[model samples]
Each structure stands twice: as structure tokens, then as C-alpha cells.
Target chain A: MKIGFDAMGGDHAPVETVKGAVDALSLIEGEIVLFGDELKINKELSQYKYDQKRISVVGTTEVIENDDKPVKAIKRKSDSSMVVGMKALRKREVDAFVSAGNTGALLAGSLLKVGRIKGISRPALCTIYPTMSGASVLVDAGANAECKSRNLLEFAYMGSLYAERVIGINNPKVALVNIGAEETKGTPLYIETYQMLKETDLNFVGNVEGRDVPSGKVDVIVADGFTGNIILKLTEGVSLSIVKELKNQIVKNSIGKIAGLLLKRNLGDFKKQLDYSEYGGAPLLGVNGLVVKAHGSSNAKAFMNAIKYAYIGVESNLVAEITEKIKTMPAFEAPVENEEENE
Target chain B: MKIGFDAMGGDHAPVETVKGAVDALSLIEGEIVLFGDELKINKELSQYKYDQKRISVVGTTEVIENDDKPVKAIKRKSDSSMVVGMKALRKREVDAFVSAGNTGALLAGSLLKVGRIKGISRPALCTIYPTMSGASVLVDAGANAECKSRNLLEFAYMGSLYAERVIGINNPKVALVNIGAEETKGTPLYIETYQMLKETDLNFVGNVEGRDVPSGKVDVIVADGFTGNIILKLTEGVSLSIVKELKNQIVKNSIGKIAGLLLKRNLGDFKKQLDYSEYGGAPLLGVNGLVVKAHGSSNAKAFMNAIKYAYIGVESNLVAEITEKIKTMPAFEAPVENEEENE
Candidate 1:
């Protein structure tokens, strides 16, 4: 099996990306293709000695920056590392594709190049958030904002499968992220989605509120992209702000600094718990091929983790399983109103 | 001025709420009607002695629990303290109403008893969030889900007015909460709201993302009720989790415990900065009368703060000012062709 890595992606591109590829290749038995400028890749690779047979370099002339628009950038920069890597996945040259580049570009390329599964209307982004209990998967973080009830049900299905297969949970609890836990609480879409999820084969846990997201109340939390994005970002901002304030307070005085030193070991554990790098990349579910979106600022460790996640995605045949399952299942049909004599 | 307090509301009920009211009455020149069972209020109030005439008791037999359905509980339990307090506000017996009861009940009662402003389609609950640079207001935190663009515009207008009048910020920056900062980033309603806000008299900052909510990027952040509620709850949950985890870590080991003791003062300052009690209660904007909804788990400090906020709301004539402003302003009209129509 082979996994394609966009070696030119992320803040620490080529160097950290190459190092991460080497680290991943050493641990996993897979042929790895690092797609980027050949000179840059070789220059970074020169400092390390590894199993050369396990690694290969694919040359790409263009690069996509963080600020570039997704679709426009993907179209104009055809030879970009992310696009080349995705193309490799589409042709079955690689088992999975991973990029820590422009998320919009990666998502756009995943849909346009790799394409969506036959039964899926729109692909959803599934992010694994580290909670107090464990990690939970939030689907459609920013993929499809204006989603129908059927789309939400699909997100639940895909998220549940990913959590159970990749995250190693059995019968993972699936929940709709609503304003409140009550059945009647949320918008029309949430109420309808709640009813739809109840009939699904997955372990539907009913509605879970925003506060429950960080508490690890459920394994898979699904919502429309708009609400999901807000939840994900709000959690991130609040966590970061708290940590920032705590650090500021910890270093304020001699005694406080001493307190910080005494609690350094535990603080390190807390930091690790809050770190997204510990979890790999967010998967763009419902795509025809496995596509993983690593963080934009990902370092060597994060990239290595993303590669490992890609390997797992391939081993589990996640894309094939999702596609087959969706195809066989009854297509989500919008409720029809029978008009008897109105005509 | 008179302020009605639901003494039986909140986690601590009559004890904390009554203490808070007494504290406020001592500090400020205002008559507080403690609306609840007279015996319970008197029992809690016996601990404090100021002037007996400054504090009065109103009788109520029913109590609304946290788990009860808000509208049903409010409708059926007419003799509940919450209802009785709101009735006082409706009858002009009190200048403002304050409650830490079921948030939905407060909102419902506020709407039913006081009614909406002449042109206001819906009332929004605005919560003041503590940020790195003090506080910012988030409107429509859960009052009205599935709002049209016009409703969002009103949220922006009302939120801006509240921030300006109550928070004392001149020309407070108002931003529409969205997934991205770009004009076309969120749902069509957000895009339309952005356009409407730009044309308004307020200091309309462009789109603000969820991460910006806690950063104090803008003075006022507005969104439809569902998204706003998720953002508000997610922020609360994340902050709570971090604090809980930090406390656990601090007390985990002998040396850490010693360190925690040494740094307790600084930690208290940090905790106070993040605490919601400092900000008081969220106001139900667009209602005919001033109403503040305190946190359900509020302590004496929080209740006192809510009383102060209600005083400010009343002093500023927040409801009257907003009601008159909306009357003359051109009402928000839906775009002839929504952005989604072209897409």
C-alpha cells in the first residue's frame, strides 16, 4: 500500500513534512510518495538516512499558499503539491492522500478531483476533538453550511462509521449537536434530523447540546457545517484563551513561577490533552477516495500523525465501506405532502 | 426604582438570590420585591439587616424546576415566582424584572407579559462574554432559532444599542457571526444581514468568525438564535472544562497542592476574570420592559451583579431607545435574489 503526502503543505513545509514522512515510513510498512519540489525534498532528506526503498519523491512545480482561494487556487495551480497528491490518490497510485495545506483548496480538490461517493450529496469534514473523557468526532465542521435534514443524517452515518473504525470504538454513540438536549429544541432541520437519525442503524444518542461536546457525552456529534464550525472554533478559542491566561498568571511572580515549576509535569499532560497534533488530521468523509486534511500549522509530529491516520484509513477501506453502505441504504427522501383535491 | 427578583430561581434558590438582593439593596438605592414563597424569602432574608422597608416580599406557591418544559411550566404554574415577578413588571409595579430561573421561562414570560416592541418581530437574548480585552455582547443566544435576515439585522441593531447604552461603549463595533470573515462565507441569511448592517447607522464591522468571539475582536457579535446559542454554550462548556481540569491538576500531588496554595491569590484573579458572575446576566432585548436572565447556577455575587445590570438597563431606557430607533429606521427587506439563488 502507498500513501501520498503533500510535502510542500503546512507552515513547516518540505523540511518538517519530509522528516514526518521518514518517521512515518519507519513505523508503517507502506510505500510513501512525497509530492513537492524535488530539490527541496532531496535537500531535506540528505540530513537523514532511512529505508530509501520505502520513500519516493514526486516533483510538483506550483504551491498553494494559506491565503489563496480554494477553487481558484486549485484550478490555477494544477501542478501544486496538493493537487498532484490528490491526483495520485484518484488514479489508485496511492491508498490515501494527506495535506496540511489550504483546507479550502484541499476540500475543493478532494471533491473536484477525487469526487464524491455515488450516494453522497455533499462531503462532510470530520474532526476528532480531544475531550476530557477521550476524543470525539465532529462531522461537517465547515464543509456544507446550508444542509438539509437528509444531509445531516448522512453526516451522522459517516461520522459514526469513522469513529467506530478509526477511533476504535464499538457502537459509537451518534448525536445531533442542537441548541438543547430536548427533542423539540433546535431548528426545523435539527428536529427532522433527530427523527431521521432515530431510524438509522447507528447508535443514535438523540440530541446533544454544545456544552456536552467538551464533556465527551457522545462519540460522534453531527450538525450542519455552520453550527459545527462555530462549535469547533469556539472550543478552540476558549481553550486557547484559558491556557494563555493561565500561562500569564503562572509566570507573574516568583512564587507563581515556582508553582508552575512544581506543576510542570502535570501542565505538560494538560497541554498534550489540548493539543490537536495528538490526533491526526480531519478526514473529508463521503469522498470516493480517502482524503485527510492536516492542520495548516502542523509540524513534523502532526504530519507524522496525519500519515499514520491515512494508513489506517486505507487499511480500514473507509471510503469503500462508506460508499457501499450508502448505496445499499434507502436514499434519504424529503417528506412528501399528498394534495388530494387542491388541483 | 423598583426591581423584581425571583428569589426561588437559580441553583442556590432563595438563599443566594435573597443574599444578592439584600447586598444590592444595601449598596444601591432601589426597592427589591423578592417574589417567592414569603416564608422562604423571609427565612433567607433574616440573615441580612438593612432597612426592612427597602426589601419587600411577594407570595408565590409554585416553583419551576430546571428540568421542566419552559413554556408549559410558565403557562401552568401561573403562581410561580417567575410569573409573579414578570406580572409585576407588566403592571408597572416594578421598573425591571430579574430571574435566574429556567431561561426559556424568563424569555417566554418576558414576551408574554411585556410584549415585543412595536416593529420588533422577535426578542433576542444577549449575553456578555468576558474576553481578553474585557467583554463583548453576543445576541440571539437562544431566543429565536431559524431567523430571517431581517431578524439578524434587528439583533445587530439591538445588540449595538445595548452595548452602547448599558456597556457605555460609544459606536460599538457590530459584526455578524459567521464561519468565515469573507462576505460570502456563511449561509445566505448572513450575507444578506452583512449587507443590511453595512447600510445601517451602527458601526458595522464586517464578518467575524467564531474564534474572534472570545478575542474581543468586535464589541457586538450577532447571529441567528441557533448558532448564537451553540457559540455561547460552547464557550461556557470549554471554559468550565478547562477550569475544572486545572483545579484537578493543581490538587493532584503534594508539591502541586503546596504550589496551588502559594499561587491561590493569583489563581483567584485568573478565575475571576473568566467567571460569568462578573458580567451579571443576559438581557432579553426588544421586549417592552427591561428583563435580565441570570445564570441558573448563579451565586449571591452573580445575583447582585444581575440586579446592577437590570438597574443599568432601566436607567438607560434600553427598551424605549431601541423601540423608537426601529420605528423610524427602514425595515430590513430580503434581497430580491439571494446569494444562494445564483448558486
Candidate 2:
């Protein structure tokens, strides 16, 4: 199987991306197709020794900066690494695609180029956040900002499948993110979504409040893209702020600094657990092909992990499973019809 | 000025509530009217000694438990401590009302009894969250599930006034919370809210992402109730989880325990900074009368701090200021018209 990589994406592009590709090629039995400016890719590749036959480069002329408008960047910078990588996935030249470039651009290109699954109205970006118990998957993090109840139910189905297949959780509990845990406690969409999810065959855990997300109470927490994005970013901010405060306290005085040294070993492990880059990448679910979005600040280790996760996505046939489920599942009744009938 | 306290509210009711009232009465020069079962309140109040003139009791026949539905609980349990305290606020017998009871019930009671300020579409529960730089206010935490752009502008107006007058932040920076910091990154409602906020006379900071809330980058972050509640509770969960994880790490081994002991002083300071209860209570803004909602798990210190905040709200004339501003400010133009005109 062949996997396409955006070699010029992320903070440590080309060099770290190349190193990661080399490492993945050695460990996994797959062909690596690197997409970027040929000169930069070759320069980074020269330092690494690996099976040359397993690694190949596709030349691209431009890079999408983080500040560029997602749709505009994807359209104008057609020869950019992200577009090139996604085009390969669309053309079936590669089985999967991975990029740490502009997140919005990756999401936009995946939908516009690689396209969504046949029956899915909206695609979701699912990210695994570390919790004390393990990790929890939050879907629609920043994908479809405004969603109906049917869209949220689809997110649940996709998220539950991803958690079970990729994250290795059996009968993963799915919960709708709401202000309160009661069925009638959220917006009309959430209340309606709660009803729909309860009717699904998945392990629907009813409504879960925002406080329950970080506690790792459920395996999958689904929401509209707007609230899901807020939860994801807020969790990241709180974790970073706490860690920063902890570090500040640890080195404040002589005794504290001494304590810091004594606890340095444990601190490293804790930091790793909080690190998003360690999770490899987030999957753009409901898409027709496997597309992984690595953190924009990813280093070589994170890039390597993203490749590993991409391999797992392809090997586990996540996209096919999601597509099949969407096809076989009961069609969503028209929202207006359902509302009128309920009344 | 007299302040009404729901003596039967919260997890540590009667005991902690009475202790907090005693503390407040001793420190602040205000009359405290404890509202609850006369016998139970007096039994707990007997533990503290203060001027008899400073403390009094108002009898209530019922109590509202945490699980009761807000509207139903308020309607059926008219003589409950929360309802009795709100009644005092409504009758002008007290300057403000403070409760650590069911948040929904307090919010419902505040709106149903005290009424909304003229031209205010919805009252918001605004909370001052402790952050690295200082505290930032989040409006419409869970009061109104669905809010329009007009409601959001009013929230911004009230929140700004509260921050400036009560929190003493001059020219407070107000932000509209969105999935991203860009002007066009959120739903149509956020985009419309952004335009409305930009036209306002307040110190509008434009759009802020969810992560910026905890960073204390802006003085006030305004959003529709759903997103605001999610951000608020997610922050709480993430903060608690991190602290819990830190404590777990600190107590894992004998060496770690020794290290924790060595750093105990600094850790204590850190914990205090992260503690939400230290910030006192969240105010139910836009109400005609002052109302503060304390955390349900509040201890004596938290309850006292909330009472102190209520006194500050009354002294600052926050309600009067906000009401006057709303009356004088131009009526909100319907956003649908503005969007069409702009297009």
C-alpha cells in the first residue's frame, strides 16, 4: 500500500517529515510518496539512509501558509504539498494522505478534492484527547460549524466506529455534549440529536455535560462543529496553562527547585500524556479516503506517529467500514416531517 | 443595605451558609437576612457570635433539591429558601440575593420574580473566571440555551458594565467567542454578532477563540448560551482534572511525597490561584435586581466571598448603570436586515 505525505507541511517540514517517513518506511511495509518541492525533499532525504526503492518524491511548487484562507489557498495553490497529497488520495494513487499543514486547508481540500462519503451530508474531524482513564474522541471539532440533529447522529456513528477500530475501544460509549445531562436540557438540536442517538444501534450513553468530557466518562463525545471546536481548544488551553503553572511553582525557590529535580522523571511522563503531538494526528472522518491531520507544530517524533496512525487507518479499513455503515443504516427522516409528526 | 441569603442551599447548607453569613456580617457593614427553616437556621447560626442587629432570620417552609426541574421547582416550592430570598430581593427588602442552590432554579426565580431590564431580551449568568493574568468574565454561561445576535450584544453590554464597575477594569475589552479568531470563522450568528459588537461603543476586542478564554487575553468573552456554557464547564473540568492528576503524581511515591512536602507552600499558592471558589460568585446579569449564584459545592469562604461580591454589585450600582445604558443605546437593528444590506 502507498501513503502520500505532505513533506513541506508543519513547523519542522521537509527535514522532520523526511526523517519520519524514513523511520516509518523502515518499520512498516508500505511505500512512502513524499509531496513537496523536489529540491528541499531531496536535501532532507540525503541525510537519511533507508530503502531508496520504498521512498519516492512528487514535486510541488507552493506551500499553504497557516494564515491563508482555506478554500482560497486550496484553489489557488493547486500545486502545493497539501493539494498534491490529497489529489493523490483522490486519484487512488495512494491509499491514505497525511499533512500537518494549515488545518482549515486540509479539511477544505479533503472535502472539495478527496470528497465526502456518498451518504454523509457533513464530514467531521475527530481528535483523541488524553483523559485520566485513557483517551476520549471528540468529533466535529472544527468541521461543520452549523449542524442539524441528523448531522450530529452521523458524527456519533462515525466517531464510534473510529474509536472502536482505531482506538481499540469495544462498544465505545457515545454521548451528546450538552449543557445538562437531561434529555430536555440542551438546544433543540441537541435534544433532538439525543433522541436520534438513543434510537441508534451504537452504545448511546445519553447526554454528557461539558464537565464529563475531561473526566473520560465516555469514549465518544459528539457535538456540532462549533461547540466541539470550543471544547477541544479550551481543553488544550487549560492543560497548557496548568502545566505552565506547575512548572513555575516547581522552580520558584531552592527547596522547590530541589523538589522539581526529584520529580523530574514523573513530570516527563505526565507531560507526554498531555502532549497532543504524541497522539500522532486527528482523522478527518466521513471522508471517502483516509486523511490524517497532524499538529502544525509536529516534530519528527509526532510526524512518525502520524504516519503510524495513517497506516492503521488504512490497514483497519476505517473508511470502508464507515461507508458501509452509512449505507446500511436507516435513512434520516426529514427534520421538518419528524418535527411536525412529533407535535 | 440588607442582603438575603438562602440558608438551605448548596451541599453544606445551614452550616456553611450560616458560617459564611457570620463572616460576611463581621467583615462588611451590611444586614444579613437568612432565609430558611427558622429552627434549622438558628441552630446553625448559634455557632457564630456577631451583633444581633447585623443578622436576622426569615422563615421558609420548603427546600429545593438539586435534582428538581427549575421551573417546576420554583412554581411548586414557593416558600423554599431560594424563592424566599428572591422574594426579598423583589420586594426591595434586600439589596441583592445570594444562593448556592440549584443554578437553574435561581436563574428562573431571578427572571420570573425580579423581571428583566427593559429592552433586555434575555438575562445572562456571567461568571468571573480566575486566569493567569487575572479574571475574565464569561457571559450567558447556561442561562439561555439559544441566543440571537441581539441577545449577544446585550450580554456584551451588561458584561462590560459589570467588569468596569464591579471588577474595576477600566475600558474593559469585550470579545465574541468563536470557533476561530478570524472575522468570518463561525456560524452566521457569530458573524452577525461580530458586526453588532464592532459597531458598539464599548471597548470591543473583536473575535476571540475558545482557547483565549483561559489565557485571560480579554476582560469579557461573550457568546450564545450554549457555547458559553460549554466553555465554562470544560474549563472547570480541565482545571480539576489537571489538579487531580498533579496531586496523584505528587503522592505516588515516598520520594515524591517528600518532594511535595518541600514544595507545599508554593503548591498551596498554585491551588489557590486555580480555585474557582476564591473568585466568589457568578452574577445573574441584566436582572433588575442584583443576584449572585455561588457554586453548589461552596464552602464557608466561597459563600462569604459571594456575599462580598453581592455587596460590591449593589454598591457599584451595576444594575442601574446597565439599565440606563440599554435605555439610551440605539435599539438593536435586526441582524437579518443588516446581513442583507451588507451583502
Candidate 3:
């Protein structure tokens, strides 16, 4: 299998991406194609030893910066690593593509260039959100801001399949993220979605509140992009602030310094669980090709993890499975209205 | 001013509520009316040494459970402490009411019994959300699941007033909690709310994302009840899991135990900053009467904080100011034609 990695992506590009590709070569059997400026890519690759036979470089002329407009950038920057890498995926030159550049550009390039899976209205961004029990798939973590009830139903299907196929959980419990657990809780959208999900053959759990997201009561939590974005980013912000506070508490003075050293191993373990690299990149599910949107500021390790995640997607035939499932499922119909207010 | 205390409310009722009343007697210069079973309230109060003249008891027979339906509980349980206290406020026998019982019940009782302030279409639940800098007022924290542009416009007004008058901020920066910072970033509800807020005289900042909520970039953040509830509950959930994880880390081993002891003071301060009791209870803004809903699991100190919050609202005439502000707001007109989708 050929996995394409964007060498001109992320804050630490060329250097980190090259190193990450080399690092990932040892773990997987797939060939890694680096897409970027060849001279710079070779220079970075020269610093690393071994894995020459497994790695190849596809030279590109431009790069997509964080500030660039997603759709406009993709259309104009044809020679950019992101657009070039996406093109490779669309042409079947690579099994999967990974990038740690502008998320909007990646998503736009995926949809506008690579196109959507058959029968899928919109592709949802899937993130592996860390929870107390383990982790769960947060579908549409920030894809479509406004969504129809049918869209969330699609997310549930995709998220459930992702949890089982890529992330490796069987019969993943699926839930609708709502304001409350009651059948009548949430906005008109969520209440309607809840009724639709209840009828699905998947292990469909009823409404789960925002609080239940962290409690790890459900394996797959689906919501519209706005709510999902809030939940996803809020977790990130709160976790960061808490981590900063804990660090301060551990290294303020003489006694704290001693304590920090004594508890170093445990702290390291704690940090590992919450680390971005540990979870890998988010996959744009329901897209025609395997595309992963890595965090913008990913380091070498995080970039490598994204490549590994891409390999998992390709190996599992995630795209084909989703197409088959969508093709076989009955056409979506809006839930019948009964109660006015949910909660 | 008479502050009606729901003595039969909260997880640790009678004992905690009576103690909270005694605690507030020394801080707030107001009479306290304890509403519940007079026998139980007095029995709990007899242990505390307090001035007899400052406290009074009124007997009520019914109690609202946490599981009870909000509207039904308020309508049927007329003799319940929540209902009785709200009745007292409506009758002008008390300046404000404090309860730590069922939130929905308190909200329903506040609306049904005391009614909305004149010119206000909805009563917003105001939470003094803790931030990195200090705290800000979160209007419509979870009162109405769905809302119109007018409802949010009023929330901005009430939230700004709460920040300035109660929280002691000068010309607080009010922002609409949205999916993005751009003009066309959010759903129709937020985009229209943004347009309406821009026309107001308040210090209205344009738009803020979910991550901005914890960053403490804006003072008053407003959203519809569904989004508001998700943000509020999600914050609570994430903060809780972090705290739990921290506690586990601090108590794991001998070195960790030493570290825990050394960092106890700084950790204590951090916990205090995020503590619910330190910030006071959420007041139902736009209600004709001042009603403070304390946390369901509030102890004596948390209850006292709610009473103190109600005292501030009464002293500042929060209800009257909001009523006047609502009366002067431009009639809400939905945007004629624009983008339709905002999830």
C-alpha cells in the first residue's frame, strides 16, 4: 500500500514530516510518498538513516498556510503539497493521504476534489475523543455547522462503523449528544435525530447529555458540527488549563520540586493519555478516499501517528465498507413529530 | 429586605439550608424567611446560635423530587418549598428567593409563580461562569432550549448588566458564543443575534468560539438555551474529570503523596477559583422576582452563596433594570434573506 504524507504541511514541516515518515516506516509495511519541495525533502531525509527503499518523494512547488482560504487555496495552489497529495489520492496513486495543514483546506480539498462517497450527503470529521473509560468517536467534531436530522443519522452510522472498524470496538454504543437524556430534551434538531436513531439497527442508545461525553457511557457520540465543535474544543481548552495548573502545583518551590521529581513517571503516564499524538489525526469519514486531517501544530511524533492512522483506514477498507452500508440501508425519512419540547 | 430560603430544598436540606440562613444572617443585612416544614426547619436551626429576630419560619407540607417533571411539580406541589417561596416573592412578602433543589422546578416556579418581567419574553438563567481571569456572566445558561433573536438580544442586555452591576466589571465585553469569529460563522439564530447586538449600545464583541469560553476573552457570553446548556454542563463535566484525575495522581504513591502535600495550598487555591460556592448561584434573570437557583448538590456554604447572590440582585434592583432595558429594546426582526445553515 502507498501512503502519501504532506511534507509541506504543519508548523514544523519538511523536518518533522520527513522524520515522522521515516519513523513510521519501521512500524508499517506500506510505502511512504513524501509530497513537497524535493530538495528540502531530500535534505531532511538525508539527516535520517535507513528506510531508503520504502520512501519516495513527489516534488511540489507551493504550500498552504494556516491563513489561506480553504476552497480558494485548493483551487489556486494546485502545486501545493495539500492539493498535490489530495490529487494523488483521487488518482489512486496512493491508498491514503495525510496532512497537518489548514483543516478547512484539507476538508475542502477532500470534498471538492476527491468528492463524496455515493449516497452520502456530507462527510463528517471524526475525532477520537479521550474519555475516562477509554475513548469514543466524536463525529462531525467540526464539519457541518448546520445539519439536517438525516445528516446526524448518517454520522451515527459512520461513527459506529468507525468505532468498530478503524478504532476496533464491536457493536459500539451510539448516542445523540443532547442537552438532556430524556426523549423530549434538546433543540428541534436533536429531538428529531433522537427519534431517528432509536429506530436504527445499530446499538443505538438514547439521548446522552454533554456530561455523559466525558463519563464514557457511550462509544460513539454524534451531533451537528456546532455542538460537536463546542464539546470538542471545550474539552481541549479545559484540559489544557487544568494541565497548566497541575504543572504549576508540581513545581513551584523546593518541596514542589522534590515532589515533581518523585512523581515524574506517573505524570508522564498521565500526560501520555491526554497527548494529541497518542490519538493520531482525525479522519474525514464518508469521503470517497481515505483522508486524515492531522492537527495543524503536530510535531514529528504526531505526524507519524497520523500516517499510522491512515494505514489503519486503508487496511480496514473503511471507505468501501461505509459505501456498502450506505447503499444497503433504507432511505432516510424524518421522524414523525409528536412532542413539541424535548426537555 | 426579606430573603426567602427554601428550607426543604437541596441535597442536604433542612440542615444545610438552615445553616446557610444562619451563615447569611451575619453577612447580609436582611431578614430570612425559612420556608418548609416549620418543625424540621426549626429543629435544624435550634443547634445554631443566631439572632431570633432575623429569622422566621413558614410551614409547607409538599416537596419536589429531583426526578419530578418541572412544570407538573410546580403546578401540583403548591405547598412545596420552591412553590411556597416563589409565591412569597410574587406576593411581595420577600424581596428574593433562594433554592438548591430541582433546577427545572425552580425555573418553572419562577416563571409560573413570579412571572416574567414586563416586556421580557423569556427568563434567562444566569451562571457566573469562572474563567482564567476571574468570572463572567453566562446568560441563558439553560432555561429555554430554543430561542429567537429577540431572546438572545435580551440575554446580552441582562448579562451585561449582571456583569457590571453584580460582578463589578466596568463596561463588560459581551460576546455571542458562536462556531466562529466571522460575521457569517454561526447559524441563523446566532447571525441574527449578532446583527441585533451590533446595533445595541452595550460593549458587544462580535463572535467567540467554544475554546474562547475558558480563555476568558469576553465578559458576557450568550447563546440559546440548548447550546448554553451544553456549554455549561460540558464545562462542569470536563472540569470534574480533570479534578478526579488530579486527585488520583496526588494519592497514588509515596512520592505522589509528598508532592500532594507540598502542592496542597496552590491546588486548594485553584479548586477555590473553580468552586461553585465561590461564584454564587445562578439567578433567573428576566423574572419579575429575583430567584437564585443554587447547585443541586450544594452544601451549607453553597446555599449561603446563593442567598448572598440574591441579596445583591435585590440590592441592585436587577429585575427592575432588566425590565426597563427590555422595554426599550428594538423590536426583533429576523434577517430578511441570508445564509440558511448553522448547526
Worst 10 residues of 3 chain B by lDDT: B334-343
Per-residue CA lDDT of candidate 2, range A1-343, in tens?
9989999999888888999898887556789999999998999899988889999999999999999988899889989999988988998999999999998888888878888786777778898978977998999888889998878888999999999999999999999999987899888998888887877899998888888799999999998999988898888888888888888887888999999999887777778778887777888998889999988888888888888888888989999999888765557433321111100
Q: Give lDDT tens digits, candidate 2, residues B44-157.
A: 878777888898999999999999998789888989988878878888999999999998888788777777777777789999978888888889888889888888989999
User: Cα lDDT of all candidates, in order?
Assistant: 0.85, 0.86, 0.85
Q: Which 10 consecutive residues of model 2 chain A have the lowest summed lDDT?
A: A334-343
* Model 1 stretches astray by more than 4 angstroms: A66-69, A72-76, A327-343, B61-79, B332-343
lDDT (0-100) at residue B105 of candidate 1? Answer: 76
In angstroms, give how far residue B152 of model 2 lies from its true place.
0.8
- Model 1 scores what on Cα lDDT? 0.85
Model 3 lDDT per residue over B1-343, tens place: 9999888888898888889889988779979999999889889888989999999998999999999999899889989988989988999899999888888888778778888776677778899988877888898988889898888988899999999888889999999998778877777888888988888888998987887788788999998888888888888888888788767876888878887887777678788867877765899898888999888788888888888888888999888888777666777333322311110
- In model 3, how large is the Cα lDDT of residue B165? 87
How does residue A140 of candidate 1 score in lDDT? 91
Q: Indicate the TM-score of model 1.
A: 0.93
* Model 2 lDDT at residue A94: 95
In the range B98-195, model 1's lDDT, one tens digit per residue, is 99998877777776667777677778999897897888999998888889888888888899999999999889999988898888888888888888
Candidate 2 fnat reads 0.76
Where in model 2 is the C-alpha error above 4 Å? A332-343, B332-343
